[model samples]
Each structure stands twice: as structure tokens, then as C-alpha cells.
Target: VTYSRSPASPPDGPAHWRPWRFRMSNDVWGTPVVAGDLLYVTSFEVHALDVATGRRQFKTKDVAWTMAVDGGLIHGSDGPTVYALDAAGGHERWRVQADAWVYSLKARRGTVVTGTRGGGVQGWEASNGEKLWEITGAQTDFETPESGPVIHGDTVYIWKDARLRALEARTGMERWSYPVGDAASCGGVPVRVCAAPDGHVYVVAGTRVLAVDIDAGMVRWHFEAPAVFLSAPAFAPGPAVTGGGVYLADYLGTVYALDATTGKDRWRIATESRQSIEPVLVTGGNVHVGSGSAVYTLDAVTGTPMWRFAAGGEVMGSPVVADGRVHFGSADHVLYTLDAAGGQLRWKLATGGEITGSPVARGGVVYACSKDRCVYALDAVKGTATGRAR
Candidate 1:
């Protein structure tokens, strides 16, 4: 079905319509990963589709709960097995068994890194699936590595044993480690990390956000919130550091803008919903975040609310900004496009199920996955379906 532009849309808004939908065999909860011309989605299986036509390029039964693509290779894991497949086709290159169930997978710089349940973090050779290094953590639930092996440049950052460790991505050499605090304080929620271009990595540890020196492996500063941070699988509302400021929201619905270098609060504002907020997206001197069923736009520096657009259901997925527009999905089984500056509803499309994954835009096309077990492609500006639905 085609979705035309909303009547309330501005005259300059692009014509919005659904171009095509590719059905999957199982429910899809992850965001569509765009690599070259192929769009990859993982459900109980992995399927690669032609980005323009929505035609199935290939499908594999590898069952990757988490997947990453780098250098023509698709790295993923299911249960205790980690595997790499050729991105051009769905052929398996190599598969290796991990000591525990793998929870996270990252592939970059000829290295495949996995964070496993109870097994800590391990690095493997991407070319051959050979084990290169393993850092064992405590076998307990609270002490195991929480999340990541988040690689930035030549360094990999991970939270294990209540501390953040930085390792060399290729050689598995220890660069440095910083103690963030007790893991139990986070109430069993996994801590996550994000690296910035300003030579610092931000981590959410319990109620505090730590800014660590990327090169020195030391905590530059930390900003503590009044409440614990809330996060979801693959959509952690971690800090967004850009242009000398770090923006984040707490579970209590308070958003803070802090000086990136000093960790001092520049401004803070509370949202209407006293619930968990989605990840913060800062761009063009504004902050975009999702809370409850609404997407809010605030001034990046002043924390002043600019506008809000309400959806039919909770906005669980984070929003992506492209070409002056914001793209996101909601539990109401819809994909929404809004003007980035003014928060006007350019268009909206209903899917068969909840859209908890964020939409991705590339080459003027937007791709989004739904719990309906399908991936839908639409024109970025016009929101029209690009190809025939399959």
C-alpha cells in the first residue's frame, strides 16, 4: 500500500509513499544494515536484499542474533557459535564456537570481536575465524562483561568486571583500563559506550556518564545524574557528544547538556513523560530524543524545547537525521518522517507490526524493519516506495 504525504505537511515537503516491502520468514527486531548495494536484516535467519528493488539477493540460516559488516564480510553469532559470511553472497566463510552464548559482535580492521555471556570478551581473526585473544571475566551474571568490544579506530572498548578496558583491535594488546564503578549499581542493565571524534569515549555507568581520554585511557570527567540511565537492546540512550557538548537523558525523563570537556552541566530540562527516553541525536545545533510516544526537538545549547511530534505508540527506536529530516519508528507499527528543524510531520506509513528499530537512509532511500517480519524501503524525500513489493 502507498502512503501519501500528510495533509498537514508543508508544501515543500517531499512526496511520501511506500515503494516496496520485502517479507521475511520471522520477526525482525534489528535495524537494517546498509552495506554497499545490499541491505541486510537478521531474524531467525539473515537475508540480503537489493537496496533499490527490494529483491532478495540471498538468504542464510546462520541465525545471527547480532551482526556486523566490515570489509566485505558479515560477522554474526547465534548461541555459542560465531560466524563470518561473504557479504557479496550468503556463503559462509568460517564459523567458530565460543565458550559461552555470544551477545554482541563487532567486525572491523580484519578483527571480529564478541562479547559472550559469562565468557567475557574475545577477539578473532576476521579472515579465517581463528581465535586471537580472550579476556575471561567472572562467571557470575553481574560481573560478566556488560556490553561492547566497541571499536574506534585502532582501539576497542569494553565494560568488564565493573571497569572499562581498551584493547588494540588487531593484536588484542591492552592499551589501558579505567574503573568506572560498581556494575551492580546499574541494576543489571548493560552499560554501553560511544566514541567521539574529539579523542574521548563516553560510557554510561549506572547513574553517571564518564568521559575517558581515548589515548590516555583515563577518566577526564564524569557527570552524575539524579537517576539511573535507561537503555534497550541495541538502542541504548547513551550520551551524544558533538560540538563541545554531551547530551543525554535519564530514566526520569531529564535531559542534560554538558560541556564535553569539563563534564559540567550547561543546561538540563525535564520532559513531560517521566519514563525512559531513547538515545539522543544532536545535529544542527539541536537535540532530538524520543520519550513515551513522542519525538522532541530541543535547542542543543539551551535545552529549550523547540517542538514535539506525537506518534500512536512509544518511540522505542532512536531517530536518524538525514538531509534536514528525522526518521524513526514507533511501537504503533509506523514509520515517521519529520522536518528536522520544525518537527512537522512530513509523512507516516503504517506497517504490519511494531517498528522498534531505527530507520536508515542512504542514497535518497530510507530502509526500516518491522516486527511484521519485513523490511520496507521508501524514497527519502518523497517517501514513495521505490520498487514493487515482494
Candidate 2:
């Protein structure tokens, strides 16, 4: 029952199958978000498609980056305007313009929030995109904002000029701000943090990695390492409650696991070469990640090298572990599938262009988009490609 735009050749399937096609523009700059039978994507235009029919349900051409969606609305930003659209019909709701480019968008309750270049932060109505309030004026100048804003209940968190600000999600009022380091000294927007399942915010700043308590907004622990900076803290769900250890990768091609509670080093692995993708920890003590042209599996607990698999090109997006497989896209214009535990090659499907967006797996389908401007939904367990040409 899977539909696709690529001429379906039943390489290994039933006889009475029909090949399908979903028409799209020649470029998909953002990722695809699948909901039910409808798949949503943004490029120069926003589109909603019937995944099983390869038919366009709705299309909106005004906005560019459809960043995040939740609470039944498609939230996005183009330049400085953050807008929301009716999730079902692609109908325009309302739009709000920020002082700088809004690159990150999120939604919670009735509000939509976005982070902007030059340290601008804003909150809006998720239903109408009305500007509820905003906060600006950080100490140092910021560059293009790319880091996401994380919301923990009513608290919205973002880094502006090297300071991570916790704001009242409703009023855009600052609750507390923590300075990671000198913003100007480390370039702009240096710290990237994620909310651990244990409720602590883990961030990387200069040579120090920090864990901050969510409610009190105080630094609970900090770890120092001489690792090259690039990757952010990654946490896995486990029984360790004092602080769930965080995993990170550095530009120097090393991965480290740090105990969240004591800021102590657990283990580190040097990936023989450089790695740009974030390390992914999967179920059953498996960690899957990629570097340059190589993918690897390591013991999630012991950091012991398990196996390594090489791809055709560089890996940019983080590897997605799902349904017993590790999925990732490469600059070589191919989407690779690997056994999550053994790092063995499953399959690699070639694309017409480079893939930067993360692969999304839902149901039994693996969905991915490439700069060549196409979105594909492949059979996750079968490697049967089903998708459209731009």
C-alpha cells in the first residue's frame, strides 16, 4: 500500500502493484514532517501530501522554513516573519516579524516561539502568529541564529550572545539567565544545550560542559575538557538519576561521555578522523554515529569500539536509529541504512542530490529529503524506494 513518485519496479514484491508519483518543486530546504496519511514539507513553498496517493493535498508558497509543528499548527519562518498555517489545509493564519532572521521555531500551549539572529527571542500565538512579546539586547553581538529553543513546560530556553536565557513562555519575560562564557571571545552563539530527561539543561561552552538545574536555573555541575567544540550534549534514558551522563562529539573527531551529576569523564573514543554528525545512542546499549565517510557503533556504556562502516560521502545530519536500523544521509547523495548493533551495511539508496536533512522513520517507512529537492519514503525494512521527483 505504500505510494511513491519514483516509477515502482517491484524488484522483489507482489505482481499487482502500481508505481506512483508525487509532484514537487525542485528543492526541499527543510525536513519532512509526516502525520497520518499526510506528509508536510517546506521549500520555496509549503506542501501537504497524501502519502499513500502521492497527491498534493494543499500547497502554500509564501513561507520558506517550516521549522517545527505541534498542537495542530505548522509553524515556520521565512526571513524575519514567523507564521502558522492550518495543519489540515495549509490556510494562512497570521504572521509576526522579528528584528532578525528567525531560524528556530517551536510551539507549546497556545504559543509559538522562535530564536533569531543578533540574539532576538520572541513568542507568539500559535493559532494566529500574533506577537505576544519579545526579548532582545544581549551584551555581545550575535551571528545568524541556528540553535533551537527548548521549552520545558512554561519555561522557554535559548542562547543569546553566549548567555542562555530562561524566559516566561507566556510573557517573554526573563526568569533567569546563565552566562556560559564570553560571547565575543568565543565568536557568537557558542553554547548549544539540550534538556535532559532528568530535567537538567546540558550545555557546551568553551572548554567546559555544564549541567544546570531547570527550576533554580543554577549550575549543578561543570566538566572541563580540551576537546574541540562543535557537538552538543546527548542524553540517553537510563536509571542513572544523579545526572544522566551526556555524550558529545568534537571537531577533532573524538566522542566523550560525561557523568551529568559530577561532571566527571566516563569514557572517550577517538574516531580516527573528523566527524561532523552527532553521536546517536540507541536501545540495548548501542551507539550509532558517523564521521567523514565512516559510520561506527560503540558500546553505549563502556565506549568500546564495536564496528565501523564507511559511506560514499560526508555525513552532516545525525544518524537516526529506528526499527533496529541506523539511518543517515550523506553528501554523496545517498541515504544509507545500517544495522544499529553491528555497523553492517543494510542498504544505500542513491539520490539525485546531497542530503542534509535528517532521515525520518515512521510506521514502516523511512522518509528523507535532499537538496536535489525531493522527498522520499522508502520501505524501512525492505529498502523499497517510494517517493516523488521534484
Candidate 3:
């Protein structure tokens, strides 16, 4: 379960390497999801592999751009058809054809909900795929990829026609709505929403960040950013709320730490390049964020730079912190493991294509997907391939 390389070894030289890589028929763009001992990934097909051995348990042509796992079922959608499969065997359990093309899919509390292309949101029974309820009247822009509904506790939050609506998760009944006004016009940048434990839900609209009271469905406070043109077409990462503060990065590579209650700025720092389309990770009193071709670590309290690790390509995915290590992928077709404390390179493994999604670590293995049509499971410490590289 471990590789022979030491932690102090240089990232570049040959070392004892063993990894398990499973190849697929098409490129993998989504991050790999680890549930129990099985790893789930999707391309033109959805494949489940053994996390420790890299053996294919099942592969089904479910063609899903969005997926969720809950209540022993794998829920996904291809166009207008929503399908639920047995998570253990990949057998079709139930399928439903929606009224329009599905834009987002999420499942929880025995309920499967979907946002459609024609401004329709429907809730279905997760156990049998039965239609439970439906709502319409909000336009979902197809150009904005981040407009998916976010489920928090028993409520589901979504944006419709420039208004943020909260719906009952199981019944699809509207609870309350808040108007975002002119801040909804952010050119083409996606709006990022995050529901925090502090009884507030944060939303990034254009140049303004709104903190809405979760219970009252009203704006508690709002912070305005400097006027600038937002022209990025990629997905913007959501804010990280923890330790009584909210940490986030703008499209211009400006990172901000704001007080969760007062919306007052604690600290802010700018990076050399535009921040990547990845979430800002705050862990171990340090903030990790990807920008241009490097991952920067800064002090969480003062926003002072700690260390920087550059990659051959842009670090477009969020860095995962686990067991005192930081793992992430890059557009250079490499998966990197770094020392969390000092930002030194532990190991680097190359895949055939760029990795746009983040890696997940469970047990002692790190799982990641690449555009090269493969999923790699590596030793968390040694960074060597272990199971089988097909």
C-alpha cells in the first residue's frame, strides 16, 4: 500500500513506482467519486472500479454529464432521460424521460431533483423514479454551466430569472425568493453559491457578493467589488466559509477573506494570473488556491504568501488536503502530491492527457481522472502506481 520513495526525494528522478490506472473508451472530464470501496467515473460510459485493485466491477453506457449517488442508487441524466442504477451492480433500476433536456441532477432524502433546459424543475422519487412535483417559470440559461441547483439540508436553492429561489427538497414547493437585481448580469461568468453553517447562504453575482439569511430568505449584507469587466466563460468556484470567515477568489485573481457576519474584509491578496476555475480550499489554517500554472498557499489569518509550487500547466482544479498532503491535477497531464506543511514536492506522475478535475483520496489511495481516458489510483505517500495500469 506504500511506495518506496521517501518524502524528501526530489520530484523528478526515477523511483519505485506502482499505480493502478483503468482506461475508458472516452475522455474523462468529471472528478472521480469514491463511495465505499468502489470508485465511480463517467465519460461516454459510467465505470465503477475497485479502489484498491483497479479492477472494473461494472461499466454501463449511462452517458451522464451530471451524476449523484445516494440511497444505494446512482442517479444520472443523459439529455432528457433520467436513469437510476444499482450502485453495486450497475443495473438499471428505473428511468424517467423529463419534459426537457436535463441541466442538473441531485439526489438526497430519497428524492431525485432535476433542473431542465426550459426553466423546469422537477422532483422525483429516488426509490422508484416516480414524479413527485414540478415547477416552471424561471429561465435557465444554457450558456451558464454553473446554474445547477444546490441542495442544503431540506431546502434546494437555485437561480431563476435573476432571482434566487429556495424550494422544498422533497416536495418542490417554493419557500421564498430573493431578487438579485442588476447584479445578475455578469456577462457569461457563472454564479457561485455556497450555503454555510453560519445560517447564511452566499452568492456571487456579477461584481457583488451577497450574504442571504437562510431562514428569512433576505439579504443580510452585500459586498461590492471594484468595477471590472468579467469576461470568463469558464465555471467560477464557490466561496469557502469556515473559521468565522468567508474565503473566495474573483475572476481577476484577487483573493478575499471577509467576516462571515459583518461582510467586512479581513484580508485580500492578488495573484499574478487570473484565479483558476476551482474552489478555494481552507485547511490547517492555510488557504490553497490554484492560479495560472501554480498552486499558492497563504496564511489564512493574514493572507501572507507562504509557498508556491508551479506546474507545467494551469492548476485548474482544487487541491485536496488529506493526511497532511495536498493533491491536485494540472493541464500538463500530471498529478502532483506535495507536502502540506512546507509545499515541497513529494511525487509527480504523468498521464496521457490534461487533468481538469480534482483528485479524491480515500483509505491510502489517491484517485484521479484525466482527459487521456484513464483513472489512476496511486499510493498516497509514495505517489507510485499500485493496482493495475491498463
Candidate 4:
């Protein structure tokens, strides 16, 4: 669920769910949310499914373009407003009008925050939608496309066109603004930043990956690739997800691992790619990634190729590693599950349409959403279909 995950109620579970599988409506974007016993999937509607049984618990109208759960509440955005809903009942707790179209929602530490298309960034009370504070006194470009704010701890990092700014989580005070660009100017290309465990940031800017120190408020080091600089919003690099240190790929199909604290180059390797190195998911001693038609698993500690599996179609979504298996969708309208340790094919299931979003799991159940206008919940082991959308 790379679109976003609830920062508070973190989802943790097995490698794959194969015994009991199920299906629901799908979409071109969005990820499923697994909180406790309920799995929330968003397509044309927001549905809450029983994690163990794959039963539809509740459904609501289009609520969250992006969603997160915190402090026992579900926070999401509908067009230009933010709504707090009961996670169990799918009922609205409160709604607040934003300054512009609210496209992203993040809730953590008892607060709900959002970023708008107009570059307006603000937060509110998670319980009743009381306005908190907004970050001010910086460049507010109406033309620059905006994105969501992600919280690591007490800081919220937001990226616009070229600048990545961090603000105090509670007071909305500006902490630092780093201008990320190449040799010439800054503020044009779409950028993404991921917080590292060492309180540093791995930023993806156009054709380079940079390591920025949160405390010092500057870049520790940056690795540039021999690729064309991408501007605006067409084929931007994926979000840099870090594990032991930093794992990111550029548009040129080069994946680099840099030391999280020292910014030392651990290893750099080329991938079998035609377009972009979308992103990497690191967990359970393995790194799951895709480029073009093949998915590769590399040793996170030594950067060794464990195995490579070429799918029947183009691997579109990022691979989610759970329950000792790698579950991902392909452009051929099929979801493939591979043995995480050996790269053997366990099973492949056909969906109604192209699988757009990544698969997510919790409690031995995996959830996938596709353009087939449905979401599927499959058993981690048997891959059986347990539920279907009505």
C-alpha cells in the first residue's frame, strides 16, 4: 500500500495469505488499510472487510482520495474536505472544509493533516476537525503541483515542485527547507522524500537520490544518475523506501544503496529495466523490486541477487513482502505470488482488470485492488476466493 499507510496503526503480518482469497471493487490508484480486524479498500467507495473471513463489514461513498488511521478514528479526504469516520461503522465523525482540493491525508500522534492542490498545507484535531495551524511565509505557487505530508515523529515533511520542507508537527513552524535540484535551478521537477530510521531523509529528485540530515537540515550526500532530468509530472521517480540504509532507483534503472548515517555507497547495480526503477520494499531480510518485465529480490545486507522472476506482463506495482512471499500485480491483469526466499512461483490469480495498486496483508490475509473496479482478499496460503463485492 505505497500510496500511504496509516502512520499510527501500523500494519504487520505474514508473507502471504493463500488458503482463503476474496475480491471486491478495484481502482487505478489507492491501497488497502489493515487496522486490527478490518481491512479498508478504496475504489469507487471505501469498504471495510473482515480480515479473517473476507466479509464486507461496511461501505461508504467516495470518502478518501488518501486515508490514514490514528487514535481510533479514520481520517480521509473527499474532493476539498477532510472527514473523520468511525473505523468500525463507516460513519462520519466530522468534516472540515479545506482551503482547496485536499488530495492527501495523514494522521499521527492524535492529529490529522492534509496537503492541497493549491499548495495549502494544514492540520486539524483528529476528533472534531478543529483547525490546527498552517505553514506560512514561503513560496506558495499556484502552478506548482502539490503532494501530501508524511509524519515521521514530531515533524511533517511536504514536497511541492523543487523544495522539501519540514515543519514542527504540533505548531506548524517551519523547521527547514531544502532546495533539491541539479546543476541549474530548483523547483520544477516532482520530488519525493522518505524518512530514514536515523532521522535522515532519502529524497528522490528528478534524476538523483539525496541523503539529507534532519537535525543539521542539509544534505549529507547525493548520488546522481546518467539520465535525463524529468520535469513536471510524467515519469517521476518512485518514493525512496529505506530499510538498513537507503534503497532507491532512478529513471535510468540504477539502484543504489547508501549508508543511512554516513551516506557511504554500500553498493550500486543495474537492473533489467526498460523505463523506471519504480521503488523497492525492504523487509524480512529481502528487498523486493521491479523494473520493466521482471521482479528481482536482492540481499539487503550484501546486495546479492537472490532470485529473479520475469512475469507474464509488465510488472506495474511495487512488490509487498509478507508471510514469506512476494505479492504484486502485473499489467496482464494477474496477481503473482512468489516464494520470497527462492523465487519460485507459488500461484498466480487472474483479476478482472489491470492491477494498479500494490497488495497489502495483515493476519495471514492479502488485499489487492485492480482497475477491474474491485479489490480482492486472498488467503495467505491456499489463494482461495472467500468474498466478492455485491
What overall lDDT goes with each candidate model? 0.76, 0.70, 0.76, 0.67
Q: How many residue pairs collide in each prediction? A: 8, 3, 6, 31
lDDT of 2 by residue, 1-390 (tens): 445333333333223332333545657765578876677877677788665554678887676664566777777778767777778888877776677877667787888877776656678878776788876754224343344666767888766655788888988788888876676544333566677768788877756788998777899988877754565678876643332367777766677877767777888888856545354554557566676777777787788888888877888577788768888898899998888777778888887788866887766567788876777767666576553342
lDDT of 4 by residue, 1-390 (tens): 111122222234332222333455345356677887787777656778676555678877765667787777888787777888899898889987888876667888877777666567787878889988975422343222233466767888775445678888878887998876432343244566677666577776666667778876887877665553221111112232433667666554556666665656678677755443345776775666787778888877677889999987888667887778888889889888888999998878898778876788666556787787766766555455433344
Candidate 3 weakest ten by summed lDDT: 228-237
- lDDT string for model 1 (304-341, tens) is 79998998998856889988999999889989999998
Q: Name model 4 segments beyond 4 Å from true.
A: 1-29, 136-146, 160-162, 181-188, 228-243, 274-278, 385-390
Can you give the TM-score per candidate against the true fold? 0.88, 0.87, 0.89, 0.82
Better of 2 and 4 by TM-score: 2
Taking every candidate in turn, the Cα RMSD to the unseen true structure, in Å, is 4.7, 4.0, 5.0, 6.9
Error of 4 at 380 (Å): 1.9
Kindly indicate the candidate among 1 and 4 with the higher lDDT.
1
The candidate that achieves the highest TM-score relative to the unseen native structure:
3
| Candidate 1 local distance difference test against the native | 0.76
The full ranking of all candidates by TM-score, starting with the best, is 3, 1, 2, 4
* Candidate order by decreasing lDDT: 3, 1, 2, 4
Error of 1 at 359 (Å): 0.5
Off by over 4 Å in 2: 1-23, 97-100, 139-145, 184-189, 240-244, 272-279, 385-390
